[model samples]
Target chain A: MRTLVLVFHPDLEGASRANKALVRAARELPDDTVTVRDVYALYPDGVIDVAAEQRLVEAHDRIVMEFPLYWYSAPALLKEWEDKVLAFGWAYGPGGEALAGKEIAVVTTAGGPESEYVEEDGGATMREVLSPYRMMARYTHAVWKEPFVVFESMELSDEALVTTGRKYQAFLTD
Target chain B: MRTLVLVFHPDLEGASRANKALVRAARELPDDTVTVRDVYALYPDGVIDVAAEQRLVEAHDRIVMEFPLYWYSAPALLKEWEDKVLAFGWAYGPGGEALAGKEIAVVTTAGGPESEYVEEDGGATMREVLSPYRMMARYTHAVWKEPFVVFESMELSDEALVTTGRKYQAFLTD
Candidate 1:
């Protein structure tokens, strides 16, 4: 399956560590089946290319969105991409079955640990935090894959980071 | 309480009907206790003024995030505001208490009806869709008010729109 990874870090070069490592693992896939796009770098000004994005979505069998979960949601660029690129007539609405049979997945890192994302603690679980994305996949008739989440992202050891990368590569090919 | 209503619709003037009415209702308050700012218009280039936004958050007793739900969440600018303005030192971490003891609320309009938000139907409920905001409130030590959601926003009748606006005005204060 051709998998498209849309990385939505505001600054993958300067700020991100987990996302950067994750991208390297994605790039290690030795074929044309995996295409990685740093979405934020492509639109520094935050203006997304709707048609080009639509074409990319159409060409991919599996679409994966990679980002650091900021303030309990994906970065601003991912939302911007949804607001602009996931046009009503193209992604949903009548005759908009572009994602009808595709696989949709999310790979995100959270600075906080798993203990924080619970009802008794933060008013939501990690699964609840990701409900919006799941909703999007359901609305578009796409098959949703269980997300890969890296908790305590700011404190990952060097060894754990490498292990995480290997697991992520497996997730991509799965 | 001094309520800051930050409206995050990309095109509130031309592209939005529900948000336009909601803003008008917010404007109808007899005094200055309710302040409405068109956030998207303020940041046309998507460049948020972090310092300015923090100052505004500090100045208010209640912050109401008003927006049209695009793809099951607030507009991109709201996430941008969180990503940039809600900085580590101010909104969370050691000395971060900008939102502490303050009221954080969301007022959003959904194009779909209330039925679509059910877990059995759309894979999530409306309350689940708003979990991220609740989590943000929890993280920042803020008080999360029950959100005011407008369902079937795109298909509301003229009378229903007016009623929704009037209800929104009341929600701003309560």
Candidate 2:
């Protein structure tokens, strides 16, 4: 299946270690099987080309959104991509079928440890943290995949980063 | 008590109905008690002024983010506000006490009906959908208020819109 990885970090080249490493791993995959797009680099002005994005979505069998969780959500550009690319007539509402039967997945790196996302002690579980994207997939009739999360993203050792990258590569191919 | 209502609608005067009404009602309150700012109008280029926004947050006892729900989240500008304005040293890291002890509330309008958000059959409940903001408040040590939500917002009757606005005004003051 053709996998499209849309990376949505404001600074992939600088100030980001895990996401850049993950992107590098994804890029190492055969071009025919995986296509990686640096979304923020493409839209520095924050204006998304709706037709082009929709076409990319249509072409891919599986869509993976890769980002670092900021304030428990993706960055502004990713949200903008959702608001603009996922248009009413094209993504939902009557006659919207671009995303139907396609698979949607999220791969996020969180700064906090796994324990912080638990249900106990009034904190949100990982499931609840990702519910919005799950619902977004459901809204468009897209098949949702279990998200891949990297906890303690900021403090990962170099060896750990390599392992995580390998795991991400496997996740993409799976 | 001072309240800051940061309205994040892309078009309050043109395309929106519910949010415009809500903002109008909030504006009708005494200036000393409530401060309403049209965030999108303030930053048409999607660039948020972090220092000014920080000053505003510090000055208010309650932060009420009012926005129309797009893709089960606020507009991109709201996410950008969180990223840029809610910085590490100011909002979450050591010595981050700007939002501590303050009240953080979300007042949103959802295009989908209330039934669509129920937890039954894997759909997200209203609480689950708003969990990101809830966690954001916890991260900043702010007190989280029960989110104010208007369901079936796109199709609300004129009278219902007025009622929701009044309820929102009460929510702000209380």
Candidate 3:
């Protein structure tokens, strides 16, 4: 399947380790199958090109959003992209069948450990935190796939980062 | 308690009705007790003044983030405000006790009716959708108050809007 990975890190190059590594792995995939775009770098001024973004979605079979979990949500730019790019009569509502039957997924990195995101731990599960995206996919008539998350991302060793990258690449192609 | 209302509407004057009415009611209150700020109007360029926003939080005992629910979350500018303004030293993390004992609440307007937000209806409840804000309040040591939501906001009559406004004003003061 043709996959498009939209990376939405505010600082993908700086102050990021796992996300950068994930992008590098995505880039290594064959261009015919995978395309990666850094959203913040493209929209430093926060003005989105709605038509172009819609066109990208139209061309891809599976759309993957990559970002670091911030305040239990996607970065501000991703929300801006959604509010602008996914307009009414295009992504949802009547005559908004552009994303119908397509697959949508999320790949996120969190600084906290996986154990912290449990009921007994007084934290929310990654799935619960990402319910908005899943609901968005449902609203747009897209299939919501299980998310791929990398936990304890802030302190990963170089070897662990490479392993995670390989696993992410497999997840994307699977 | 001193309450600060940060309204984040992209077009407050043009495309808003209920929010505008609510702001008008808020303005009628005593200036010393209620402070209202239109976030999008203040940051048309999307470049938030982090220091100033933090100071606003510090000056108030309660903060009410007022916005129309866009894609089941706050407007992009509100997320930007949180990402930049709620910094490590001032909002959370070490030495980030500025917001401790403060109260945080959300007042959101939705185009959909209240009945649509039910599990049996294949929809997410408002409480589940708003879990992020509750968690953010928890993380920051800020008290999480029940959200005030205006349902079917797009179709409210003038009388209904005024009623909602007055009730919202009471909610703020109480």
Q: lDDT for each of the candidates? A: 0.91, 0.93, 0.90
Index of the highest-lDDT prediction? 2
Arranged by DockQ with the best first, the candidates are: 2, 1, 3
DockQ for candidate 1, please give it: 0.83
Off by over 4 Å in 1: none
Badly placed stretches (over 4 Å) of model 2 are: none
Could you tell me the lDDT of residue B9 within candidate 2?
95
lDDT of 3 by residue, A19-110 (tens): 99999999999998999999999989989999999999999999999999889888999999999988999999889988889999999998
> Quick one: RMSD of model 3?
1.3
Interface RMSD measured for model 3 = 1.4
Q: Which docking band does candidate 2 fall into? A: high
Second chain TM-score per prediction? 0.96, 0.98, 0.98
Q: Candidate 1 chain A, which ten residues in sequence have the lowest lDDT sum? A: A114-123
lDDT of 3 by residue, B2-117 (tens): 99999999999889888999999999999999999999999899999998888889999999999998888888998888889888988888899887899999999999999878
> What lDDT tens digits, residue by residue, belong to model 2 across residues B48-119?
889999999999999999999888889999999999999988998888889999999999999888888888
Candidate 2 chain A weakest lDDT stretch, 10 residues? A118-127
Question: Which is the better candidate, 2 or 3, if ranked by DockQ?
Answer: 2
Inter-residue clash pairs, candidate 3: none
